[model samples]
Target: MTQENHQKKIITNEDLFDHISGFKLEVKKTVDDFKSEMKESTNDLSNSILRLESSVEDLRKSTLEGFDMVFKTIDDTNSELREELKNDNIILRKEMNQRFSVVDKRFTIIDDRLTVVDDRLSSIEDNMTYKHQLSPKFA
Candidate 1:
């Protein structure tokens, strides 16, 4: 009976060792599967980030292009307005010069008429002084 008990104890120890080995293999397989799943999740996140970055870049470019077009149109309109104002200023100056020329001609004619009237007044004064004998020679 003692010898049989020793043999049974030996078999129990062997069975325990086999169970431990099987548990080790299962743990290794579970760790490998977890690593693969984590790697796949990380790759997916990286791809999504890249796509989001690309979309943001595209939107930025389009917005800049729209702003550039608006600025260019404003510049063109400003240039046109400046040119029109210059033309209007030039036309007004020409018209003013023409009016000044006509006014100058009218002033010259008035001056000539005033000179003739002054000559007539001087002759009348001389005749009146002689008829009245109011000169120094008559006194």
Candidate 2:
């Protein structure tokens, strides 16, 4: 009976209130710490996202600049090639015209020589016919 009485526990109102108050304080502290850690983690994630976005934007700008340079180079090269082709075409036309003029002059000279030779051959034929009619040996 004495051991059973010693084993029984007694709780006072003041002691219970104090214990409950202390437990409430500990729980509030734990909750505040958890909220603070979550806030820090959220801020870190946001910063990482911002950095990734900035890197992507920078890469996009660089790629566009590179493309612009390539297009400009192509345009400049095309313009130069077009101008060169035009000049070559002009030069070729001039050379062909000069050659054609020289050919025309040669043909004119040949035509004149052929006309003179034809006249001479006609005169020789007339003289041969007269000789044949008078000599009577080529009838």
Candidate 3:
């Protein structure tokens, strides 16, 4: 009876030890799985952040390029307008000079014709006076 009781106590202790070891192993596996999932989540978040940063950089570049193009276009338009105005002013000045030249020439011609008429009238008057004086002396 003493030997049988000793054997039964030894078997119970061995079974209890096995159950405790299995529970500890299961707990360790669960903790390891949780750590792996957390690492994957952190990696996914980092990748998302990197992609968002890249997108923001692209947007900034595009916006700057658009602004540069707009400024260039405005500058080109302003230069073209200045050139057109300068050309118009030059043409206007040339037209005014031509009109003034025509008027000056017309006035010079009129003055020359008037001087010729005055000279002819003075010559005729001198001849008539000389003829009248010679006739009275002959009579």
Candidate 4:
């Protein structure tokens, strides 16, 4: 009976150890699964951040290119407008010069006609003075 009891005691100890080992294994597996999930989450977050960064960079580049295109268009338009204004200014100057030339010619013609009238009046005044002197002497 004592030998049987000793054997039973030994078996109980072995079963207790087996139960503790199973519990240890279960705890270890749970910890390992949690670590794996954390790693997956971290990787997913990193990938999302990378994609976002790439998208932001792409947007920045696209925006800069759009601004460049807009500036270039504005510069081109300004150049065209400046050229048009320059041509218009030249045409205006030519037209103004032509009009001034016509006005100058008309002024010159008027001045010549006035000079001729003045000369004729001066001659008639001299003749009237001579006639008045001669009639007084005859009377």
The lDDT per prediction is 0.89, 0.95, 0.87, 0.94
Give lDDT tens digits, candidate 4, residues 1-139: 9998887777576798999999999999999999999999999999999999999999999999999999999999999999999999999999999999999999999999889889889889888888888899734
Ranking by lDDT: 2, 4, 1, 3
- Could you give candidate 1's per-residue lDDT for residues 1-139 as a string of tens digits? 9998887777576698999899999999999999999989999999999999999999999999999999999999999999999999999999999999989988988888888888888889888778669667655
Model 4 per-residue lDDT at 12:
71
Q: List the residue pairs that clash in candidate 4.
A: none
Candidate 1 stretches greater than 4 Å from native: 1-26, 126-139
Q: In candidate 1, which residue pairs clash?
A: none
lDDT by residue for model 3 (72-100), tens: 99999999999999999999899988988
Name the top lDDT candidate.
Answer: 2
Q: lDDT score, residue 91, model 1? A: 97
Question: Which portions of model 2 miss their true places by more than 4 Å?
Answer: 1-23
Query: Which candidate leads the pack in TM-score?
Result: 4
Q: Model 3: how far is 19 from its true place, Å? A: 5.6
